[model samples]
Target: MASSAELHQRRSAAVARGVSSMIPSYVSTAGGGTMTDVDGREWIDFAAGIAVTNVGNAAPRVVEAVQAQVERFTHTCFMIAPYEQYVAVCEELAALTPGDFDKRSALFSSGAEAVENAVKIARHATGRPAVVVFDHAYHGRTNLTMALTAKVMPYKQGFGPFAGEIYRVAMSYPLRDGRSGAAAAAYAIGQIEKTVGAVNVAAVLIEPIQGEGGFVVPAEGFLPAIAAWSRAAGAVFIADEIQTGFCRTGEWFASTHEGIEPDLITTAKGIAGGLPLAAVTGRAEIMDSVHPGGLGGTYGGNPIACAAALATIETMRELDLAAAARHIESVARPRLEALAAKHPAIGEVRGRGAMLALEVVIPGEDTAAGPAPDAVLTAAVAKAAHELGLLLLTCGTYGNVIRLLPPLIISDDELDRGLSLLEQAFASSL
Candidate 1:
C-alpha cells in the first residue's frame, strides 16, 4: 500500500487545488473515536469529519445497514422509482426535527443543496425574493449559499458574482459584541426593517449554533426572538442545523435548546452517519408550495444513503447519544475551562455538548479591549496536536477558533487522551 507521503504526492497531482483537507494522513480504518492511517499510526479523532460521523466513524448499525443496502440496491433514483427508505428517512426527520406541526421533507445530495432548496421553498411559499442571513454565518459553498455565507478569503473571495437579494446582518456574538440577546436581536431586526424591509423578506436563515463560523452560539433569547420576528414578518425562519443536528448538541436539534420552533430546518452532516445525505424539512404547507417536480436531484435520497440514515437514527435512539453528548460535555468542558484559565492565549471557551471550541487570541493585559485573534497560534497548535496523534480542526472567520467536534460515541478514555494531547499542543504552541 502507498504510504501517506506517496498518496499525498499523488493527491497533489490529481485533486483540484480548490479542495483542501485538514490532514495529509490517509486513513485506513476508523471506529468510535480513533482512526488508523495507512502508515499504521492511530489518531484520536476530535474532528469527526467536521461533525459528520456523530455515531462514530464505523458505527456497527451504520456499517451493517450500508452493507445490507449495497447488496439490495445502490441507486434507483428516488425521483424516478421512489423507494421506502427515502420516505422512511423523511419520516424520521419529521419526527426528530424541532416542530410539532405537520411537517414534510425533501432529500438532497449535500448540505448546500438542502439550504438551496430551503430558500427555494421559502421563496415559493412567500412569493418574496429577499433572504436574510447573519454575519459570520456559513450556509455552504454553492452559488446561492455562497451569497448567504459571510466569509471572504477562502469561501467567497473572487467566487462572485453570487446570487442576489441575500442580506447579511449582525449575529448575536456575545464575545465580540457585548449586547445581550434581546438587544442583539433588536439591532438585527432593526437592520432588516430599515434596509431590506421585512415585508419583502422570504426567509430569515441562520445556524442555531453557528458551525464553521466559529461555533458562535447566539446569546440567550436571540434565536427565539429571531424566529418570532421571522414569523411576524411572514418570512420562513430557517435553522441551519446541518452541523448541530442529531446528537452533536446534546439535543436532537439545537433549536430545541432555545425553545424556538423554526418554520424550516436544513439538516445534513450528522444526519446519515457520514453518508452523503441532506434534507430540507419544513411545515407541510410550505413544503407543498413547490410543484411536484421541483425539489429533487438525480442522487437525492439514494437507497443506500437513506438506509444508512435510518440505521444512524436508530443507533442514536438505542444509545441515547444525546445523553452521551451531555456526558461528553460534563467531562470535557471543565477541562477546557481549566486550560483557558491557565493560558491567556485561549481567549474564550464556548460551545455545548461535544461541539466545543477554544478561540485562540494574542494575550494582552487590557481585558476590556478584548484579545486579538491569533490564527497563527491556532494553526501551530493544530499542527502540534496532529504530530501528537490527535486530529484537530480549526475554523472561524478570523481562522483562530480551534473547534472540537468529537463523536458523541467517543469513549471516556479516548476523549481524555485527546484532550490531554490538546493541552500538550497548546503548551508547545503557546
Candidate 2:
C-alpha cells in the first residue's frame, strides 16, 4: 500500500485547497475508538469523524445491513421509484425525534441540506421571512446556512452575498456572558422583538449545544425559554441537533435534557453510522405545509444509507449507547477537570456525555479581565497530542477550544490511555 506521504502528495495535487484534514496520516482501517494509518501506526480516536460514527466505524450491524442493501439495490431515486428502506428510515425518525404529537420526516444527503430544508419548511409554514439564529452558532457551509452561521473565517470568509432575512442574537454562553439562562433568554427575546419584530419571524434556529462554535452549552432554561417565545410568536423553533443527536449527549437528543420540544429538529452526523444521511423531522402539519415535491433531493434517503440508519438506530437501542455516553462523561470529565486545575491555560472544561471541550485561554488574575482565548496554545497542544498518536480536534469561533468526541463504544482502557496522552500533550506543550 502507498504510504501516507505519497498519498498526501497526490491529494495535494488533486483535492481542492478549501478542503482540510485534521491529521495528515491517512487511515487504513478504523473501528471502535481506534484508527490505524497506512504507516501501520495506531492512534486512539477522540474525534468520531466530527461526531458521525457514534456506533463506531464499521459497526457489525451497519456493515451487514449495508452489504445486504448493496446486493439488493443501490438507488432508484426515492422520488422516482421510492423504496421501503427510505420510508422505514423516516418512520424511525418520526418515532425517535423529540415530539409526542404526530410527527413527519424528510430525509436528505447531508446536514447542510437538512438544515436548509428545515428553514424552508419553517418559512413556508409561518409565512414569514425572518429567521433568527444565535451568536457563535454553526449551521452549515451552504449559502443559506452560511448566512445562519455566526463565524466569518473558514466557514463564511469570502463567501459573501449570503441569503437574506437571517438575523443573529446573543447566545447564552455562560462562561463569557455570565448571564443566567433566564436572563440570557430574555435578552435574546428582547433583541428579536426590537430588531426583527415577532410578526415577521419565521423561525428561531439554534444548536442545543453549539458544536463547532465551541460546544457552548446554553445555561439551563435557555432552550425552553427560546422555544416558549417562538411558540408565543407563532414561529417554528428549530433545534440543530446535527452534532449532538443520536445519544452523543447522553440522551437520544440534547433538547430532551432541558425538556424542550422543538417544532423542527435537523439531525445528521451520528444518524447513519457514518453514512451520509440527514433529516428534518417535525410536527406533521408543519412538515406537510411545503406541499408535495418541495423538500427532496436526488440522492436523499438512498437505500444503503437508510439501511445503515436502521441498523445504527437498532444498535443504539440494543447497546443503550445513551447510557454509554453518560458513562464516558463520568470517566472523562473528572480527568479533564483535574487537568484544568493543574493548567491555567485550560480556562474552562465544559460539555456533556461524550461531547466535551476544553476552552484554552491565557490565564488572568481578576474577574474584570476575563481569560483571553489562546488559540496558539490550543494548536500546540493538539499537535503534540497528534505526535503522541492521539487524535484530537479543535473548534470555537476564536479557534481556542479542544473538543473531545470519542465514540460512545470506546473501551475503558482506550479512553483512559487517550486521556493520559492528552495530559502528556498538555504537559509537553506548556
Candidate 3:
C-alpha cells in the first residue's frame, strides 16, 4: 500500500473536487466494522458509506457473490439481455418489503436514479403531472430530485434549472414544528390543495424518517394520514425509503411501522451491501404503468450488482439484521439521550432503529439560546471524531446534525467504542 501522504496528495491532485471526502483521505484497509489508514492508524466507522454497508464492509456473503459473478460475466444490460440475478433481487425485494399486496420491482444504479424512476412510474400510472415533497427532505441530486429536496446550499446551490412540477410541504419535525400529527398533515395538505391542486399531483414522495433533514421521525399517525390523503386525492404515495429501507430502520422498511402500503417505494444504499444498486418496488399495476421502452438503462441492473444485492438480502435474512438493528436502537438511544443531557449543547437526539442523529446547538448546550445549530458545532464534533480515529457525517438542513449510520454489523464492543469517541468529541467541543 502507498503512504497516506502520497495517496492524499494524489487524491487532491487527480480526483474531482466536486466530491468532498472525510478526513484522512487514505483508509488503508476496511473489513467488518473498522477501517485503517496506510500508517496503521485504525478508525471505527460509523458513517458506513452513508448507510450503504448495512451488512458491513467486505461481508463474506457479498464478497463471495461478487467474486463468483466476476468469474462468470459482468454486464449484458438488463434492457437488452436480462439476467437471473436481477430478477432474483427483485423477487427478494417483493418478499422483504412490507405490504400484503402484490408487488413489482425495478432496478437502478443509484438512490437518485431509483427516486426519479419512482416518480416516473407514479406519474405514468396516475396520469398526473404534479408531485409533492416535504420541507427539509433530501431526496437526491438529480434535476427533479434536487428540486424535490428541501436543502439548498450544498446539494442545490449552483445547480440551476431544476426540473419543475415539484412542490414541497412542511413536515412535522416535533422539535421544531411542535404540532400534532393531524395538524401537520393538515398543514401540508392545505398547502398542496391550495397551490398544486391534488388532482394534478401524481405522487406524494417522502422519507419515512427524514434522513438528511436531521433524521427527524415524523409525528406518529402522520404517515398513515398522508397515505389516506394520497388515496383520497387519487395520487400514488411514493415512500422515498432510499435512506430508511433495507433493515436500517429496525424494521425492513420504516413505513412498515406505520402500516402504510405505499404505491411506490424507492430503495438503495444498503440494498446491495455497498454495491451500486437501487430499486423501486410497489404495486405491480402502478409499476407497469410506464411503457415497455419507458423504463430501463444501459446498466440499470448489472448482473454483478444484482448478485451482490441478492446476497445482501439473503445475508439480512440469515443474520436477522432487522432484529440486530432494533437491538442497536434499544441500547444506543438511551445512551445518546444521556449524552445529550450531559452535553447541554446537544439540542436534540432523535431517530429510530440504527438511524439516528444528535443535533448540536450553538448556545443551546450552555444557554437557552444561541444561533440555532448552524454547522459550527457539528463540524467541530466531526473533526474531533476524525482526530480520535473515527469517521462520521454531519447533516440537517441547518447543518448542525451529527447523523450516525454505523454499519449494522458492528459488535457490541465496537459500538461502545464508537459511542465513547462520540462522547469525548462532544465533551472536548464543549
Backbone clash count, each prediction separately: 0, 0, 3
Q: Report, for every candidate in turn, its global Cα lDDT versus the true structure.
A: 0.93, 0.95, 0.88
Question: Which regions in candidate 3 have their CA more than 4 angstroms from the true location?
Answer: 363-371
lDDT of 3 by residue, 1-430 (tens): 8888898788889989988787865876787668888889988988989999999988999999999999999999998888799889888889878788899999999999999999888888988899999999988999988999999988999998889899988888877777788889999999999999988999999998999888988999889999999999999999999888888989899999889888888999999888999989999988887889899888898899998988898899999998988988887898999998887778788888889899877653332223366577789889999898779898888888998888888888888998999989988876
Q: Measured by TM-score, how close is model 2 to the native structure? A: 0.99
Worst 10 residues of 3 by lDDT: 362-371
What candidate 2 gets wrong by more than 4 Å, as runs, is 365-370
lDDT of 3: 0.88
What is candidate 1's lDDT per residue for 249-352, written digit by digit as tens? 89999999978888999999998899999999989999999998988999999898899999999999999999999999999999999999999889899998
List the RMSD of every prediction in angstroms. 1.3, 1.1, 1.9
| lDDT preference between candidates 1 and 2, better one | 2
Steric clash pairs (candidate 1):
none
Clashing pairs in 3: 28-36, 344-365, 345-365
What lDDT is reached at residue 307 by model 3?
Answer: 88
